[model samples]
Target: MSRIMVIGSLNMDIVSRVENYPLPGETIKGIKTDVNPGGKGANQAVAIARAGGNVSMVGAIGTDVFGDQLLEALQQENIETNNIIRKEGTSGLAVITVDSKGSNSIILLEGANGLLSMDDLTDILPEAIKDPANIFLLQNEVPWETTKNIIESLSASNASIYLNPAPAQHIPTEIISKLTGIFLNEIEATIITGLSVIDQESASAAAEKLIAYGVTEVIITLGEKGSLYRDFREHVYFTPGRKVNAMDTTAAGDTFIGAYLASKQQGYSIEASLEYATAAAALTVSREGAQKSIPYQEEILQFLT
Candidate 1:
C-alpha cells in the first residue's frame, strides 16, 4: 500500500438535520442533532484509511473531551496519530446544518486548528518528505502561513503534494505551481479563478485558467454533476457523477479526494481513479455524518462492480 500523509485540521462537528434551510432571520425546527468527528483533513485521512491506504495524520487538537474523541476516532480508523499535537484549549469545531435533500451549510471555528504553526511542522515533515514515494495531502483548514511553509519546505522533495483548497483562499502563483494535483468544488474553483463555474463549458474554462497558473493538474468537482479534470499537457475530461439518493453530503468531497489519491497511489490510471472516487463519494452521500459515511475499499469495489 502507498503511504499517505494528511496535514490539516481536526474538528468535532455539531450537526443538525432540518426540513429546509432557514432564510435570513428565519427560525426552523431541527429534526435531530448528532455530534461527529470531522474536519477536512481528518475526513480525508479517514477516507484514505477506510479505502485501504496506509495513512498518517498530522495536526493539532485541544485537551478538551472533544479532542480526545477526535484522536480516538482517527486511531479507530487505523490512521497514525503519533504526530498529532494536543494543546491546552478547545478543539476546532464545525456547526453544520443538513436539509432534507442532503445539502449542507457549515460555520467553522478554528480553535486549536488555528494554533498550528511552522514550529509544529518542522519536526514531523522533514522525515516524511525524505521519501519520494510518500504523498502529502493538504487543505486550507489550517492557517495559511502554516500551509505555505510546509509547501515551501517540500517543494524540492520528490513526494507528491495534493491540495484541496476548500473554503478557498488566495494562494500565490509560485506555491500553486508546486502542487502535484488540486481538488476543489465549483464554488472553490470560482473563488480561485474569478470565473463562474455554473456549466461544463465554464468549469472547463476555469480549470484551464488554473493550469495556466502553473499547476500540474486541476480537478473541479461539481456536486451531483461529477468532476472535471485538466492537466498541464492540455488533457481535459469530465467524469459523470454516480446517481444515488443523497442522505447527507457531508464529507462527500473529502471522500472523493481521498479515494482518488489512494487509487492513484495504488497505480490506477487517472480515469480509473476518478471512477473509483466518484463511486466512493456516491456511497458517502447515501449515509450520514463525516468519517462515519465514508465507505471501505470493499464496499466501493462492490458498488463499482
Candidate 2:
C-alpha cells in the first residue's frame, strides 16, 4: 500500500437535520441533532484508510473532550495519530445543517486547527516525504502559511503532493505550482480561477486555467454531475457520476479524493482510479455523517461490480 500522510484539521461536527434550510433571519426547528467526527483532514484520512491505504495524520486538537473523541474515532479507523498534536483550549468545530435533499451548509470554528504552525510540520515532513511512493495530502483547513511552508520544503522531494482546496482560499501561484494534483469542487474552482463552472465545458475551462497557473493536474468535482480532470500535458476529460439515491452528501468528495489517491498509489490508471473513486463516492452519499459514510475497499469494489 502507498504511504499517505494527511496534514489538516480535525473537528467535531455538530449536525442538525432539517426539513428545509432556514432563510435569512428565519428560525426553524431541527428534526434531530448528532455529533460526529469530521473535518476535511480527518475525513480524508479515514477515507484513505478504509479504502485500504496506509495512512497517517498530522494535525492538532484541543485537550477538550471532543478532541479525545475525535482522536479515538481516527484510531478506530486505523489511522496513525502519532503526529497529531494536543493543544490547549478547544478543538475545531463545524456546525452543519443538512436538509431533506441531502444538501448541507456549514459554519466552521477553526480553534486548534488555526493554531497549527509551520513549526509543527518541520520535524515530521522530512521523514514523511523520504519515501518516493509516499503521498502528502493537504487541505485548506490549516493555516495558509503552514501549508505554504510545507509545500516549499517539499518542492524538491520525490513524494507526491496532493491538495484538496476546500473552503477555497487565495493561494499563491508559486505554491500551486508545487502540487502534483489538486481536487476542488465547482464552487472552489470558481473561487480559485474566477470562472463559472456550472457544466462540463466551464469546468474544463476552469481546470485549464488552474493548470496554466502551474498546477501539474487539476480535478473539478461537480457533485452529482461527476468530475473533470486536466493535466499539464493538456489531457482533459470528464467522468460521469454514478447514479445513486443520495441520503447525505457529507464527505462524498473526501471519499472520492482518498479513494482516487489510494487507487493511483496501487498503480491503477487515472481512468480506473476515477471510476473506483466515483463508485466509492456514490456509496458515501447513500449514507450519513462524515467518516461514518465512507465505504471500505470491498464495498466500493462490490458496488463497482
Candidate 3:
C-alpha cells in the first residue's frame, strides 16, 4: 500500500464576502468574514485524506496561533503531520475576497512558508525513490527554489513526482522532463505557456506546448468547461464539469487534483479518476471555504452513485 507525500505550504485564509469587487482606491463593505485553514499543499492533503487515500504532510508553519490551528485542523482530518516544521515567525496567510457570484481574488503573505528549505525535503526521497508506488506531490506556494531543488533531486529516482504549479511561476523545460505530470488550472496553464486558454481548443494548444516543453503528461482543468488530460502518446481524456450553483470556487481545483490522485492511487482508470475528480470539484464549488468545502470519500461515492 503506497501513500502520497505532500511537501509544500500551509496557509490560513482570511476570507471576506462582498457583492462584487471594488475598483482600485474604492472602499467597499463586506457581507461577511471568516477564517479558514488553507494553503495549496494543505488543501490537497486534506482532500486526499478525506477522499480516503493515505497521505502525509510536510511543510513549515510559524509558531503563531494560526499555525497551531492549521496543525490541529489537519490532525482532525486524520492527515499525517509529523514532518511539518515549526518556524519562529508568522504563518503563511492568504487574504481572500469572494464575490457573491462565488469568484475569489486573493493576496498571499509567505511568512514561514518561505522558510521551508530544500534540506527539509531531502530525506523523504531516498526510500521513496526506490519504489514506483510512492507518490510525491508538490505545489508553488513555497519558495520556488525549494520546489526546483526537490524536482531536480528526483531526476534519478523512480518515484512518481507530480507538481501542481499554482500561483504560476516560470518553470524550466528541464524540470518538466522529470515529472510524472502536472495538474493545474487554466490560469496556471496560460501563465506557464504564455497562451490565452479561454476554452478547450486553447487549452488543447497549451497542453501541446507543455508536452513539447518535455512534460510527459498534462492535466488542465477549465472551470465550467471541463478538464482534459494529455500524454506524450497523444491520447486524450476529457471530463465535463458538472453544473451547480457555486457558492465559493476557491477549493474546487484542489479538490479535483486530490480526488484524481486518490482515485488513481486506489487503482481506478484514468477516465474514471477524472470523472470522480469532476464530481468532487462540483461538490467543492457548491460550498464555501477551502478544506471545509471538499467532500469526503463517502460523499463523493454517494454523489457518483
Encode model 1's per-residue lDDT on 12-94: one tens digit a residue: 99989899998999998899999999999999999998888889999999999999999999999989999999878999999
Model 3 pairs whose backbones collide: none
Sorting all predicted structures by lDDT, with the top scorer first, yields 1, 2, 3
Stretches of candidate 2 off by over 4 Å are: 18-30, 99-105
Per-residue alpha-carbon lDDT of candidate 3 for residues 1-305, written as tens digits (9 for 90 to 100) = 79898988899999998998999999999999999899999999999998888898999999999999999999998898888999999999999888887678879999899999978766766756676787899999998988988888876764688999988887888888888889878888988889998888888898999888877889999998899889899988878899989877878999998998999999999999999999999999999778999999999999998
lDDT of 2 by residue, 121-188 (tens): 77898888767888899999989888888888887884689899887877777888889989999888
Global Cα lDDT for candidate 1: 0.91
What TM-score would each prediction reach against the true structure?
0.93, 0.93, 0.93
Per model, state how many residue pairs clash.
0, 0, 0
Clash pairs, model 1 backbone: none
